[model samples]
Structure formats: C-alpha cells, structure tokens
Target: MVELVVQKYGGTSLQTTGRMAEAADRIIKETKRGSQVIVVVSAMGRTTDDLTTLAGQVSSCPPAREMDLLLSTGEQVSCALMAMALKAGGVEAEALTGPQAGIITDFSYGDAVIKEVDPEPVRSRLKEGKVVIVSGFQGCPGGHEVATLGRGGSDTTAAVLAGALKADRCEIFTDVDGVYTADPGTITGARKYEQLDYESLSALAELGASVVHPRAAAAAEAWQIPLVVRSSLTEQTGTTILPGTWSSCSFPVIGVTSETGLSSFSLHEGADRREIGREWKNGLCPWKAVQHVKNRLYRIVVRNEEAPHTKSLLSRFGGRPDTGRALVHVIFRSKEGKQKAGSFMRDLPYTQDCFMVETQPHVWSMDVPERHRVNICQALHDRCMEKEAAPISAAH
Candidate 1:
C-alpha cells in the first residue's frame, strides 16, 4: 500500500513566488516517491497582517463576520497559486477552499472550532492521482458564511485533516528545521532535538515555542498521529514527535520556552476572584492563572493582543493592570529535572522586578522584564540545559 502524508506549509515557507515554486517541487518529488500528498497552506508572507491593517483603516471596529470573510481570502490566494505551481511542475493538482474540501466548523466567526471533516472530497482527488491543496485557515460554519480558525489555525487544519484521513503522518514545514532547546535565533549553541514525545512538544508549544501550535499538537496526540517538524528550504531531517515521553538518563529539563507581549492584572484585597474570573468572557484565555490567592493579591496574565478588551472587562472588578511583561518557562521531563531547575531559579541573580513561581511540577514560570527575557533564557540554557544535552545538535 502507498503511504499517505499531509504536508502543511506555513506563511514563511510560501512567502514568495520562488518559495511557492520550490514548495511545489518538494510536493512533486514526494509524489514521484509513490506517496499520496495533501497540501495545506497559509497566507503568503504578511498578507494576513496587511489585510487586518486594511480592515482597521476602513473601520475602527470592523464586524467580526466581515473581518473573517476578508482574512479567509489570503489562504485561498496561496492555495490556488500552489496548484498553479504544481501544474507548471508537470503534476496534476487541484486547489480547494476549506469548505469545498468539506471542513465543517462551529459558528464562532473569528476563531471557529472544527466540528468534523467529510474526507470524500479530498479522498476522491487523491484517488484520481492528483495532489489536493486545501486552503488552511477558513471553513464554513453553515450556509455561505466563511469562518476562520484564528492564529496558527493552519496548523490545526493540517492536524485535523491528517487525523480524519488517517494519513501515515503530518509534516509541518516551517522556517526552523526542528524543535530546539531554546529559540535558536536568540540563544547561541541551542540544541535541536531529533525526536520528542507528544506531551513534551505540547508543553513547549503552550509555553510559547512557535515551532508548533498547541492545539495542533493536542489534536495530533489525541489521534495518535505522528508529526514531523521540518524546514521547507533544507533537505535535513527534522524533529519527529511520536508517542511516549523521553525515557533518557540525561537531564530531564529538555527545553526552556518564553512568551512576550503580555499584560497582567492584580485584583486587590476583598476582591471577588471567582466572580471576576467567571464574569470575564473575552476571546483571550489567561496565560498564567494564579492557582493560589496569596494575601491581598490575585493576578492573571493575558495576551497583549486582547489586552484592551481584557482591561476593559477587568476594570469593573478593580483589577489593576501592568503591561510590558514576559513569561519564561523551564520545562522538565522528570521530577529530578524540575528540582534542579527550581534550585537554579532560586540562585539566579536578578533584580526585584523578576518573580519566579512553580506553576506546575514539571514547569517553572517567571514574570520578568520583557527586555531581559532573552538574556535570562540564555543564562538558564547555558547553565542548566547544555551540559546534559550533549547528544543533540548545537547548530541552529
């Protein structure tokens, strides 16, 4: 039986016409290898950002439904161009929108959840020996209305399609070759993993590693589908995420991840934490939820993109806001690793502004100055992570 693979190309991989052509050639090469291929693509380059800017210029507060309709076009444009490129490469291919490909989603306009996938449309195309290229981010909720699956939705799209189709594996092509112990761009001598378990990858993604989206990781894990993170521009084999945790004798703290562009709210004494938490019904979820209310203060961190709405919602409950903060997480694979990292965090030298807390047994989160986040991550990686991860590649 022939292998079936679902490949997802992110925005950077399809940013230019030349890049798109290269991607087409990549697909062509795979088809020649006797693998059935389905392609999922994101908006080319910064097309989504450009469109959002245009929408904001026209209306201060654009309607959610119309905004989604506008953003969905970006993926369509890229998918069609990819099909054209594949044809130019002498391969039979077809372009499809999310709905046309049979992705049914919920009614949420901006961040719709996929309800189910009717795989026949894509399956028939594959049977015809044609590569099926589906627009990644947009799906139809019902009728003719187009709904989008927010940021990193394309990743979610590919994962879901792979699961529904029971493809052999899902290949996510991005700018990076694989998952790293730290952001390769920021930290020197950052080690790259050849393989990881689904739980570790999901933890890293949720802690602000952009190599893969958290939801995509979750979906792939639930379906027990294997995933590979590779670079579209290189021939090197990337990291493969499979079942089971790392059972290595090396350092259990495998990676350190950080998220910036965040704001926090501190509710004062006598404040109803439960009431405020329950009443806050915004699009953004808390990055860090204060598990234990200590003394007079209870705090929550939210993404900066939703800060305005979040601030407005919390103002009613006397929530004081602090902007320009970053969250750094040291992720460990075992209890021993966590213990070592916790000790390092306590000994690390920092000013009074930095606050460290162990939110989970396997993770330690720090609220530090946004400007010093890189330095902090670098310091942690060099001292705690590098010595134990000798087998991994130090090359970016």
Candidate 2:
C-alpha cells in the first residue's frame, strides 16, 4: 500500500509563479519517493485581502453569502494554478474545489464549520496516479451556497483531509520554519520549539499564534494524526505536534502569543444576554473574550475587522465598544504557570491600564493598549527564557 501524505501550503509559499513552481516541485518530489500526495493551497499572497478590500469599496457592508461566494473564488484560482504548475513539471495533477473534494459544511457563510468529509473523491484520483490539489477554506452545505471557513481555514482543511484519508502525516508549510517561544519578529531572542504536544500547540494557536489554527490542532488531536510545521523555503526540520504532554522544563511557561487590532465591548445593565448570545452564534463572529466580571457587566473582545458587525449586535442591548485594544497570552505547561505569570505581571511597571485575567489555569491573558503589545510580549518572553536558562547556568 502506498503511504499517503497531506500537505498544506500557505499564501506566502504560493505568492508568485516562481513560488508556485517551487511548491509543485516539492509535491512532485514526494510522488517520486513513492507516496501519494494531496496538496491544499491557500489564495495567493494578498488575494484574499485584496478581494475583501474590493468588496469594501463597493459596499460598506457586503452580504455574507455573497462575500463567501467572492472569497471562495480566490482558493479556486490557487488550486488551478497549482495543478498547472505540477503539470508543467511533467506530473499528472488535478484540481478540485472544497465541494468537489466532498467537504460538507453548515450554511454559516463567513466562518462555516465542517460537518463531514468524504475522501473517496480524492482517493479515486490517487488510485489514478494523479496528484490531487484541493482548494482550501470553502465548502458547501447544498445547492448554490458557498461558505468560507474563517482565516487560517486551510490548516483545518489539511488536517481534516489527513484524518479522513488516514494519511501518514500532515505537513503545514508556512513562511516560518516552526513554532517558536514567541513571535520571532517581536522577540529577537525567541527560541524555536522542536516538538510540542497537541494541548500546547492548541493553546498557542487559540491564543493568537499564527503558526497553526486552533481547529486544525484540535482535529489533529482528535484523529491522532501526526502534524508537522515546516518552512516552505528551507530544508530545516520544523516542529512536530504529537499526542501526550511533553515539557522541556519544569518552569511551566512554554510560549507567548499576541493579537492586535482588537475592539472590546462591555455589556452593562439592561443588556439582553440571551439575544447577544444568539447574535454571536448566528452571525459567526469571532469573539476573543466573553467573560463575566462583576455586577452584571460582561467584557467582550473581538477583532477589528468584525467590530462593525459585533458593535451592531452589542448596541441593541446597551453595550459600548472601545477600539485600539490588544490581547496577549502566555501559555504554560502546568497550572502553576498562571500564578507565576500573574505575579510577574503584577510587578511589571509597563502599563497600569493593562488588565490581567486567568483565562485558563495554564493560560494568562492580558488586555493591553495596542501601543504596548509588542513591548509586553517581549518582556514576558524574555523573563520566561531567563527562568528556562537559570537551571543550566546554576548547574554549570
């Protein structure tokens, strides 16, 4: 039996014809190594963003269904172009949209959840000795409806396909080599993790690490699929996410992640909590937080892109919005991690306006001003690394 491999290439890896050709070469090499390859491609660099911008120019608020219909086209372009590149490399390859590949989802338009996937469509192609390239991020419920999974949806598509096909492994090729202790762009001394458990990666991804999507990490965990994160431009080894919790140290803190462009809201007295819940669910909005603080007051954090829709939902219930906020999370390996992080945050004199919350026993979340996001991440990351290195220094 031939081993099956599921590979996902992000926008940066397929930004140009040269890059697309590189991806095609990578896929062809795998076929030569005696493996059946299934390729998942994202829209080329900035295509999705460009499409969104174009929609905004036409309408202040585009209809969700139409937006999905428009966004789904980006992935189709990528899939077709990738197939052409592979063919030019003298390999038999075919392109299929998400629906054509048998990905079924609900009618949520913008952020649809995959209901089921039938791998037979892809398997048939594999049996024909053709490399299959599937458009990621868009699936259909039924006739004439196209729904896009939210940002980073390609990662989820690859993981789900790997599980459905029982592939040997799922490799996610991105611009970065692997998952790091912090965003390397922000923290210059950040360390790259060689291996991470599902729980750790899931926590990091959910908290705002762009390395992997939270749903993808969860699906891989559920299916017990081996997931690897590698660099598309280099041959260096990347991070492997596997089952079981493994730690490199007892310090507990493992990574730091930060997200900007946030709009926060506070639901005060007389707000209809139930109605707000329905709107959130039905609207498919990404709420970063919905925590109850005190005295019937609830704090909600959402991305800036979805703020307009979220604000409209909030206003119906006496809620107020505050933009230019940022969220940073410190992920840890143990419960004790929270206490340590909390103590450190309390003592740090960075910003008095910052508020800390114990989102999870192993996750410390901070709501800070956008201006201080990078500084806070850098400080916390450096402190964690200091603790990590202390033990070795003492032994020496």
Clashes of each: 0, 0
Candidate 2 lDDT over residue span 1-396, tens digit each: 788999999999999989998988899999999999999999999999999999999999999999999999999999999999899889999999999999999988899999999889999999999999999998888886779999999999999999999999999999998988888877868877776778888888888889999999999999999999999999887888877763544557878898888988877776666666666667577687665555343777888988888888678666788889999888877667767777777776775667764355577788788998988988888776665642121110
Pairs with backbone N, CA or C atoms under 3 Å apart (clashes), candidate 2: none
Model number with the top lDDT: 1
In candidate 2, residue 263 scores what lDDT?
Answer: 81
What C-alpha lDDT values do all the predictions have?
Answer: 0.86, 0.85
Candidate 2 regions off by >4 Å? 246-251, 265-287, 290-302, 305-321, 389-396
- TM-score, every prediction: 0.92, 0.87
What TM-score does prediction 2 earn?
0.87
Please list all clashing residue pairs in model 1, or write none if there are none: none
Model 1 segments more than 4 A misplaced? 246-250, 266-287, 291-298, 305-319, 358-361, 390-396
